[model samples]
Target: MTDCDFLVVGHGLAGATLAYVLRQRGYRVLVFDPGQADSASNVAAGLINPVAGKRFALTWNANELLPAAASFYRELEQCFGQQFFFEAPIFKIFGSLDEQSALLTRSPDHPWGDYVASLATTDPGLPGVQAPLGGAWLRHGGHVLVRELLAALAAQGEREGWLWRETFDWTKLVTDPTGARYAGRVQARHVICCEGAAATQNPYFNWLPLTPNQGEVLDVECAGLSSAQVLNRGAYVVPVGGGRFRVGATYRWPPFADGPTETARQELSGRLAAITEQPFAVVGQRAGVRPAVRDRKPLLGPHPTVPSLSFGGGYGSKGVLLAPRLAGLLADWLEGKAELWPEVDLRRYAALYRPAAGS
Candidate 1:
């Protein structure tokens, strides 16, 4: 058995980022991943949009989260010596004059307007594309190659003797006043559950509201297409070099399953047609289940009754943009450097966990 400072379960964006943060803070960390369920971060394109939607509104907490995510990922890339994060601008293609008019109606001096990188009254003349109404370039918008990121993060952890490739068992977990013992193989000061959707089944964190949302994306090869900016209207077409683009993703509530559906592929292809007249060949399609909360806030902080247990999950689609910042916050809280944000605190939903009406 080996002792450590922190044991993180689930190597998805949530777990991996938290492990990286804790490791950076000089904490002895061990990470475990059970490939028993779908991970939303695996197939995530990692697109970070500042100004989004038809109204060209800023993404939630863009002003603060954007810069933090930017610097955080940049430093990670340099530290890991991998080409994982791509800094690119997203172009919001206008479908109609009303869309453009409504966007212009908002004062540029507004706080949200700071994220609008730029806009053009006329089309930017992207080849094989039909943006007759032009589009706007959003700043602080980019993507992290999630698959590469997780792999690189795990490799780094392994190099530091902080990563394990095995399934963590709940029955073997025993928590005392000081720390936790896992199957007598690993001992840790705290056991944080970053198990994504599987957190819904965790005995310690199961009470928290976690909704599984399924999303799908298609990888395609198109010749003679510009490999510059990300284009978005109803769907997004992101160039991944070599004239290939990863276009996706269909967001469905009450997800039927965590697998690619024919319906989603057809829907994505249909939407991709709006980006350009150029025909493309579909190479592959993938899907994963994202962990979302009822209030759309992150699920973080230590277990209410177990000080040696902690949790960080429910990042949903914004995992790339939210994970770094949230991990820092959680790490700080764990080290007694800060308090957990009320919006994301697990205690907020304790009422549901408590026995009801004098049971």
Candidate 2:
């Protein structure tokens, strides 16, 4: 049997970043993932926005999380000799005059001042965007090439002999007071489930209020649009080099539908039309389910009863920005260097875990 310090199940953003953090700290880490193409990390736009929703409220803990994520991605870029993170400004178009007035009403001394790079009251001249009410130029926001980053991390892990391209079979996993053994081939000092939306299916973590949310996006070729910044209204249009842009993100809550749908395509296309007058061709469509939680906070820390087994998911749409920093904290907690932040600690929901009958 191969011995390791951590056996991480799933190689999505949460798993990949956590494993990288743990391995960097000199732990023997093994990662298992079947490489689902539709996994949230693979399909996510990897947007790092500090402000959210129609109210334009600052994202939860943006001041701390944003900078940490930027630094973390930069460190990875230095290590891999590849650029995966792109720092770009987000042009948030105002939906109406009321919306524009509301944003302007916030004083310059408002907490959001730090993130506001600029504000416009008239059409900000972009090639074909239809922002007559103008928009806000949000700084310290951008996108990460999530799929490429995960692949790079997986390659490095493989070269170091710690990543496996296979599904983690629950039937073959044996957990006890000491640790966890998998398929009789690998024994780990601790096991962490970073499975994204699939965590709802994990017997160990199923009790957690993990709600799977389906989201879809479209890849389009818009020759008229510039790739300098991301354009957002109800949906977003993210430039991905050349004349190609990724548009979308239609959210579908449970009683979940499967795969890309014609309805979603029309919805996104309509939003795209509202954002720009530029004619674009739909090149591709992709969909994935986000691992959301009841409280909308990430799930971290060990299982209430099974102390050696832990979880690190429920990042939902903010995985790209939240994962890196939270991974470090999880590592610190695992190493007994610190405590898990209360908001994210799984103990917040410990009352939900009821042991199986006669287990």
TM-score of each: 0.94, 0.98
Q: What C-alpha lDDT, on a 0 to 100 scale, does residue 342 get in candidate 2?
A: 94
Candidate 1 yields a Cα-based lDDT of 0.83
lDDT of 2 by residue, 1-359 (tens): 99999999999999999999998899999999998999999999889999878889899989889999999999999998999999999999999999999888884657695898888999988888899989999999999999899889888877877888888887688989999888889999999999988988888889999988999999999898868999899998888888998997989998767789999999999999998888999999999999999999999999888868999999999999999999999999999999999999988998998997788
How far off is residue 99 in model 1, in Å? 1.8
CA lDDT of 135 in candidate 2?
Answer: 94
TM-score of 1: 0.94
RMSD of each: 2.3, 1.1
Candidate 1: give its CA RMSD in angstroms: 2.3
Each prediction's whole-model lDDT (CA): 0.83, 0.91
lDDT for each residue of candidate 1 in 92-142, tens digit (9 for 90 to 100): 888889887776676465657567767776889988777898878777688
Give the C-alpha lDDT of model 2: 0.91
